[model samples]
Target: MRTRPSPRSRRHRRTRPRSAIRLTAGFLAAAALLVSACSSGNSTTSAGGRVEAALAELPRSTPSGLAPYYTQRLRWRDCGVPGFQCATMRAPLDYDRPDAGDVRLAVARKKATGKGKPLGSLLVNPGGPGGSAIGYLQQYAGVAYPAQVRARYDMVAVDPRGVARSEPVECLDGRQMDAYTQTDTTPDDAKERNALVAADRKFAESCGARSARLLRHVSTVEAARDMDILRAVLGDRRLNYVGASYGTFLGATYAGLFPARVGRMVLDGAMDPSLDARRLNLDQAAGFETAFRAFVKDCVRHSDCPLGGRGTTPAQAGDRLHAFFRKLDAHPIPADGRRLGEALATTGVIASMYDEGSWEQLREALTSAMKKKDGAGLLSLSDSYYERDADGGYSNLMMANAAVNCLDLPPAFSGPEDVQKALPAFEKASPVFGPGLAWATLNCTYWPVRATGEPHRIEAKGAAPIVVVGTVRDPATPYRWARSLAAQLSSARLLTYDGDGHTAYGRGSTCIDTAIDTYLLRGTPPPAGKRCS
Candidate 1:
């Protein structure tokens, strides 16, 4: 099993909190799969209206330096996925210096399938800062987004620079990554702490060695700028968008930077921009604990519950689970063709926390590991979180997760001592998974590149109305974050989903989906403070 950044993150606190601050835990494959299963894929209508919002920015009269990027026509060719086409976009490696070479970002789209006047391009991002928008487009959004929206608008996604096919960041080989993920994060002594620190250092050094030239340029600001270039290229005076999880942050950044160019936009599973690295990371730990309790409450309902029976309290359940982790810390169990240790086991557990639907699978996995000595179930869950294939190779998801996370903000802790000092508060915040997540926040501290951003509010003063969706019991991005983000964006309307999981839209809520679909097609956001259970 391996770890990640979420509130962006893994199944364990040791893996860093999944995706919010690290924001890796965002818009995960699970959510994509859910869309495939839960969505009707049929919004057949003769609706012709696409966003015609008044956007001030235009390509004409463009500055000579940036004109070439803005005016170039796309040469779309068939992507491997049928009905979808792919192309590459050229963005300056550094916006400050147009002459400083270029970065090629991968773009994919599925043209409007309906026979009405097309609405123009609707871009989608599944977060990660590191997550592949292109992949999400090809796999989920291009096909599974509301059919009416798909019918009128060209579904498009651009892999942010240093993510997926867009010159992805490379740091460690699968074997090296395996070791790094296995490193004991909740160090009991100085020696273990030193080992953890060394691993973080080595991981940072490897990234710098292999990807230094592109590292500093992959910040969210740059990616938002890239979206503007894409907006011009797509012939859209205003950009229409669907951004989930960390993607919410990206979309918000674009809105803040180019409020005039922003159009009908939806930010689901929103991340708050006003919090510092430590606060975000710590908030994520509490989020995981929140998800964990949700899982426990669900588990106790069934007879096969491993942690406890129907009347067992969540705290009692947490203690039992933590004890099991401690036992594995001493002697690992065997499963999944490998030994299941504390780190991997914890990661496996945390992976399911992203979605409550997986609580059943998690219960069975916990039972096999706790009672039967068969660890295959938990190991499978962890491997999926790491995106490990049967061949043992890994996708660049975790690597890019770290590269963007480390560069976006300073490390949550300057050193292990700071982590030590913060432990009590973290534990109080999240008794089940606090300590390791606090340690996981240390990864950015050793990054080779200094941070280019800090905690700040995003107030897109004159942008068109943008819809923000938040799930109250969401694990990765807490519900409050959505509230916070909506408050920050001057023209944003908040849509609350009193539910579970990482994101809200198209995850089996007609009220939630209808509000967003109307906004996307009709450019009418729901009333602010709208709540849907």
Candidate 2:
């Protein structure tokens, strides 16, 4: 699960509310798998008009100090899954002082398979701020993208600095992370709150101790700059890309910094760059509420509904789920030596919200925990979100997620006192998940490095046309974010999917697939206000 920033101007640092992690995990997973399943591998016409125009508009000379970094060559070799080649590219650890040191980035690509002349390379990021783009490409995108697009454009991905296989930022060991995930996010007393604070401080201190030099330089701004260098290294005149969830933020930052080089870009499950940490958390809490209501409506229609019956209202269903959580908080269900408490149960529920297909699994998990006292189901879901392997090891997803997020915006709260003051508003947004999420915002307050980026708009004024896709009931990156982002970008086209789940494209929506495919293949975005259900 990735952390999300909040809104309201203040001196506090950004943290990932519990809700934010739930939402981001769902979308990040969906974005990686949904499109892969729907891609039709068949030849199609190429979109040739925009590339030339975009390339012609690029600046004649690279920035003087950055030329060497951008011009460096990559030595590709066969690695990971078959039909894929991997390479390592060197980027300055600090852009301001290129001679100081360097960070090695992991890059991978699958050559175009089309019969005609290739358009160029198309880069993809599956969000997380921590999610592995190389893993996503090798596992999904390279083989799943529409055969037409895959045939013409080489699909590429680079693990951002401080992310997976890119000098990753380390935090707690597996056992420690397991404990962290089980920590009580909603404190009932000062003691519990202090414990939470101590845990966060420990997490920050660990990262600082082990990754001191890289901590301050892992900001999203730095990652965006890295993308520019990757663009030049790949010999692409302009960037052609697909970014989802937090990846949308990275892609937008790139466009803002290099507007003239923007080519065909698609941002799904978009994040609004204009809001601060507090507002982002509150809005995301509300978004989860909207998705939960939708889930209840669907759940109660079936006879096996865990929360309520067919006659129960969504509000009543939410109350029942809340009651179940309270029960678990007091007496956690046993599962594989670990107990399923409110934290893990709530996470398990939130995990299912990202994709509708997970609803059945959630239902079974809830039933087992509520009726049979078996918590393995929900615990399994929580483990999946945390990327916990069967052998008990963890990926760097959570660490890099926190590293990038904490550096991108101010913390949502200064301390537990601030969280106490904000509880009512958060509860008002989501009675089921609000209080825990509000308290979860304290994670970044104790960070070792101060934030380097601030909340701002990204207009990308001179960029070519960009497509912004939003799901009406998206649990993580809300639909409103897509609307706001489209409004903020000078040349953005909004494509709405009046549906459930996080992102829209290739998630069983033929209408959405056609519109996005048209944009990618023909360089003609769907008309503004286009709606797909």
Which segments of model 1 are wrong by more than 4 Å? 1-3, 7-62
Model 2 CA deviation exceeding 4 Å by range: 1-60
Alpha carbon lDDT at 190, candidate 1:
93
Q: Candidate 2's C-alpha lDDT?
A: 0.76
- Model 1 residue 90 distance off true place after TM-score fit, in angstroms: 0.4
TM-score of each: 0.90, 0.90
Q: Model 1: how large is the Cα RMSD against the reference? A: 9.1
lDDT (C-alpha) at residue 296 in model 2: 91
Q: For candidate 2, write residues 284-361 as lDDT tens digits.
A: 888889989989988988888888888898789888888998888789989778789988888888777777767888
Location of the lowest summed lDDT over 10 successive residues in candidate 1? 29-38
- Give a tens-digit lDDT track for model 1, residues 1-533: 12374423332222222333233311121111011111222222212322212112222355578878988888999888899999999999977678889999999999998967889999988777676777677767777777888999999999889988999999999899888878886788999899888988898889899998998888777788789999999999999998888888888878876788888999988988666677776777788888888898889999999999989998999999989998998899998678888888888888787866678889999999999999999989888777778888987888788777666655667788988999998898788888877787766777888776655566777889999999998877888988988987889899999988878776678899899998988888899789997
Task: Please state every model's RMSD to the true fold in angstroms.
Answer: 9.1, 9.4
Residue 524 C-alpha lDDT in model 1: 84
